[model samples]
Target: MSADPGSPSAAQVELDGVERVFHLGDSDVHALRDLHLRIGAGEYVAVMGPSGSGKSTLLNILGLLDRPNGGRYRLEGRDVTTLSLEEQAQVRSRRIGFVFQSFHLVPRLTAAENIGLPMMLAGIAPRERAERVARALKDYGLEDRARHKPDELSGGQRQRVAIARATIMAPALILADEPTGNLDRSTGVEVVRLLEALNARGVTLIVVTHDPQLGARARRRLLMEDGAIKHDTMAAETV
Candidate 1:
């Protein structure tokens, strides 16, 4: 289903009978099986499951980083399952933001340059890129560290820079995978609060985490097992 154009939310995602299979040496492993899901715009959702339960696979599919072997995916009301590689890349660049546990920032680039990388890759003009990067750095409380490279920053600082870069594109959806896995308890809390703030501002946020404390903070939760959703908090709530 599509989001209302006049609504404050910006994106909607739907998956119908999606399946993903990987070939091992002589056997096939199903990573996702007939998984059907819908995420409305501006929702805060946590995906929780044990290792090999398909949490990361699900995130990859939603972020357009991987294609499903069966079924269809619709994002913002358009069937994106069949888009060409170039088309998918275009859509991913403009519409999706991702935060990883390792804080995937360029080791050689300074914070400002890293934050501006997406715009640069998209061929945005230098002046506009600089302006937006500056705003993001300030917004993420990394203004003072803009000139610092990743190695020079602390774990928390590096994560802040990563978050800034992720959001610089103003993406309709933000996907975070173990976003706080490398930080201390306090720092992790700080990082999650930052993500939550973005969600509060109407960005769709989906997080994959093993931390029950962190998962509990989401408005809705999905429990995955054997490549399918075993429980959905929203569905239970409605019933």
Candidate 2:
């Protein structure tokens, strides 16, 4: 990575000739069509579109949660389209982090436990997990709430916990889908700021959102409609 964030080098994620079709009873629903995208490290990009514009479908493919019916996808220079499901899962765990509209915190787990869940799943040592979890709690201002379960936290706090968990593994790419959708405007702004700060540190940030104001804040914007990219632009100031 270079000091210039926008300069293209080895892409974090790439899609070429990507097409996604879904079977709806008998008819085929085209969700994404011939989409080509390259996201470089440290870039802050936003994907925007109305409902049924294939935004979520595109995101699913980027996160390796779904496969395109046709085309190729490369993640960190590896041709991921050829990997098995288990292999894809490993790659996703190692390189990608996701935050959804809903906080998606485990209702049964405390904030600290939820933040440490990824490390736990990867079989990290108890001592190291405790150390990392402690840092995450303080970094995200959740130290005081570490013992609070999801039901005990506010909406903003829950989202913060989710963000903390998502970044715990230090993934190369963070894919956020309406990360602030469920929060109030002020809280949403705060969450967005946190995500931007992460991007400033060279973590690739790709956000999908229906809010135009939120989308425009990104350095680069991609608009999708009818299962294809309708417009792609980089802010003049970003260049």
- Candidate 2 C-alpha lDDT tens digits along 1-239: 11111322223788999999999999999999998988886889999989999999998999999999999999888999999999999878767888999988999999999988988988889998898888888888888999999999999999888888888878788899999899999999989988887787778899999998888899999999999888999987642
Tens digit of per-residue lDDT, candidate 1, span 66-143: 999999999999899999999999999888989999998999999999988989999999998888787777778788
C-alpha lDDT score of every prediction, in listed order? 0.88, 0.86
Q: Work out the TM-score per prediction.
A: 0.94, 0.94
Error of 2 at 191 (Å): 0.3
TM-score of 2: 0.94
Q: Candidate 1 has which clashing residue pairs, if any?
A: none
